[model samples]
Target: MDGKKVILAEPRGFCAGVRRAISMVEQALDYYGPPVYVRKEIVHNHHVIRALEGRGAIFTSSENDVPEGAVCVFSAHGVSPEVRGNARGRDLRVLDATCPLVSKVHQEAQRFARAGRTILLVGHADHEEVEGTLGEAPASTIVVESVEDARALDLPPDADVAYLTQTTLSLDETAAIIGTLRERFPALAGPATDDICYASQNRQNAVKALAARSDLVLVVGSANSSNSVRMVEVARNAGTASHLVSNVEDVDVGWLDGTTAIGVSAGASTPEFLVDQLVDRLVELGYDGLEIEETATENITFTFRPVWQTEEVVQP
Candidate 1:
């Protein structure tokens, strides 16, 4: 123990939803055999996707890329009706691996759209999750990426509107956008518990706490993970120097040489092994003060298979 300290943010890796989604892929492979094609990355981590690929999961960026009559699994980020339609058209045996939380947001979108409300989806327009949520009602939904987008919206002054959000966004950022949307719409409708996932909020909150007592924060996650990126933002916003690394190899000891205490956190989809690697590397570098700082306890778990999986079909 070289005397410097390491603090681990609580509720850091593999949230319930991500765990459920990955399990679906693994189970599908066991039941359906080799060559189970998965739509998109399944989760945002490249290492995760690579590991699944090694297990015989084929990842295709587009639904059309899968051959006809093949077993296809949707990624955890969810997908649009158009993608669903494409899968159906190709006669793919589709097993949806979407997190139920995301499905809930889609349900809200559909309910709002059906109730004749113009939907304001608050999220990055290009994110896969947002694209899927917006596709719930293409003609009735618009994406508001920021406060400016909310302010510049051109809907009729008296138009009925409801809003939903991408699950991986920061709670504060989404709230600010929602605040602006409400200011514009006067009577904007929305979800009761907010669409940002519980796990995302927890990791961010944990980072805030860790940042306060540490000189540097290390967020173990991937570049494409929205929640991972947001965790870095949370740490930085809390007045600590932070870096997002895919793993320990990406860690620059240079960022920690002068640091007395280090805060460590991981994205929802990040594997626990990566966090372990980071901690081990830091100890090797002489930062041996170790402490586990837990900001929350997550007991939530998902228990159900996608409806599509239950349908009677030929074994592949």
Candidate 2:
């Protein structure tokens, strides 16, 4: 609608993990010449991936596709032990970019397996993170993506049970799934701390706050981005009409037909540039005013430098 206001959510776009992953690729490119191979989309943001690609990083779906001795960086989603082993067998110089939170899940999985417990992983079956975590203890872990899955999961009668979740998931939905799991497995052991990372929870909370005050919500993120997709769901669940767009081109003008207030938020992996582009597009589409809703402040940062660096700056 003409002369409508656009509300933006703070703590949107680029979580610490995504920032670290991108920086890993950039640093790798700078430290080790061109063609630094990365396995999988670093963080599911096309713009971020393209920016790195332009800077001479090559992305591959499998380690086998990479030259044996070339430096390879794993995606933020993390990788299976099998993938790690395969890379090691090939003697690939590896730099893991898995988020520390996700690594926490992996460590829990290892502990549960070592304790001879059956692990229930709460996430989509095919997601790279789930696949990697599943690989952690394939024989002892089962993937459950929904409350329904939790309800119908048939586990060994006497098997000790525990659960770990994907870092980026709809908070309420995951909570419901966990509720069902606890109901069924009275003895289930969950993470000592919540597995859903702080960034995911904060972003969703921010989007819910933005969606409540706006007539419509626009989520800036790739379709495959778990956190971005969950943000859209969170907004809709808050009773606001929400659309998840990869970029300005994906924003449907028809959704603005009668909306007077629109809110914009980005996924953890999305770059600020894409958010700016989306806001600019909204202005072009007749939303002239802008307001930012600050739900929380993010002071967290992560950094990594080569072992040879004389001085490495790690921020928090």
What lDDT would candidate 2 get against the real structure? 0.89
**Candidate with best TM-score:** 1
lDDT score, residue 273, model 2?
90
What's model 2's TM-score?
A: 0.95
Quickly count the clashes in candidate 2: 0
Q: Residue 73 in candidate 2 has what lDDT?
A: 89
After superposition, candidate 2 runs with Cα above 4 Å error: 1-3, 156-158, 307-316
lDDT of 1 by residue, 39-128 (tens): 999999988999998999999989999998988889899999899889888888888888999999999998998899999999999899
Backbone steric clashes in candidate 1, count: 0
